[model samples]
Target: MPDLITPTTRLYRAWLDAHAEWGPGTHEDGFGLTSTDDVGSRAGFASWVRRLGDESARTTCRWIIEDRQVLGGIALRHHLDEYVRWAGHVGFGVRPSARGRGLAGWALGRMLDHARLLGIEQLLLVCAADNMASATTIQRQGGVLEGIRDTPLGPARRYWITLTPPIG
Candidate 1:
């Protein structure tokens, strides 16, 4: 798997910028939509690393796909029961130069593996009702559509994926 996942670091600045400029589309936007310009700075990126390292409360992780020479990332923001109900265990994005290569789907599958390790039984993945690609991705991961909700962005569809007992 080429260690397809890792912590976000200063070394990833170039990768981050590439994906950042790609911006948002589909029924969703970029993966790090909540991040500020400061968060994209070196110092700010360091702070983000520290927060993700907490491993308690809400844990976050950013993983890059190494096999493909593509700017892609997956982010898991834990404690979804609080700030997010429509969102799920993770959100991810693949740069415009890398779309249609199955990188998002691959990254999402890896995120689910990590979620299972964290003892998450079910994951809620939310996408814009018009995001066929995202909905297809979630469904490919065994997700079942729960319903839809009106949000500031637009109407979002919620899908739930149940992890098996083994969870491996």
Candidate 2:
């Protein structure tokens, strides 16, 4: 089973391996990595991890780990902002090697539980319109389509998932 963990410098090597597999881009959606984050050096990685820790009030970022290997990442934003409006309240990505094992669905379910704890009654998620796998994953979790919108990244499907309170 894969577990979600807070980003830490101790997993630097593992994280780098995953990052490299994504092959040079700022599009690793769930990791909260920006173009400016320098994660290439030890000090830089430590600082990056600290920054993620500092952003706890506004967001929750978790790494998907299995057997001590970084498999992917998932993030949930606590509140809406301009970026969140475009990117959605939640985002996730699984490494290429980890794609077919249902990890995204698992991570998303976990994040929805976290959202409920934070009092967020619903969440918005967007994915490239052609991403059938992601659309299917969200649909499996009760996501309702809200139509596709053309954005800087091209047409993207928007979905909303309402959270039902846990049973006693």
In candidate 1, position 23 carries an lDDT of 57
User: Clashes in model 1: which pairs?
Assistant: 88-124
Candidate 1 lDDT tens digits, 85-131: 85666777666766787777877887788787777788888888998
* lDDT against true structure, model 1: 0.66
C-alpha lDDT of all candidate models, in order: 0.66, 0.91
lDDT of model 1 at position 43: 81
The local lDDT score (0 to 100) that residue 42 gets in candidate 1 is 73
- For candidate 2, the 10 contiguous residues with the lowest summed lDDT are 159-168
**Per-residue CA lDDT of candidate 2, range 57-156, in tens?**
9999999999889999999999878887778999999999989999999999999999988889888999999999999989988899999998789999
Best-matching candidate per lDDT: 2
What C-alpha root-mean-square deviation, in Å, does candidate 1 show against the real structure? 3.4
TM-score list, all predictions: 0.79, 0.96
Clashing pairs for model 2 are none
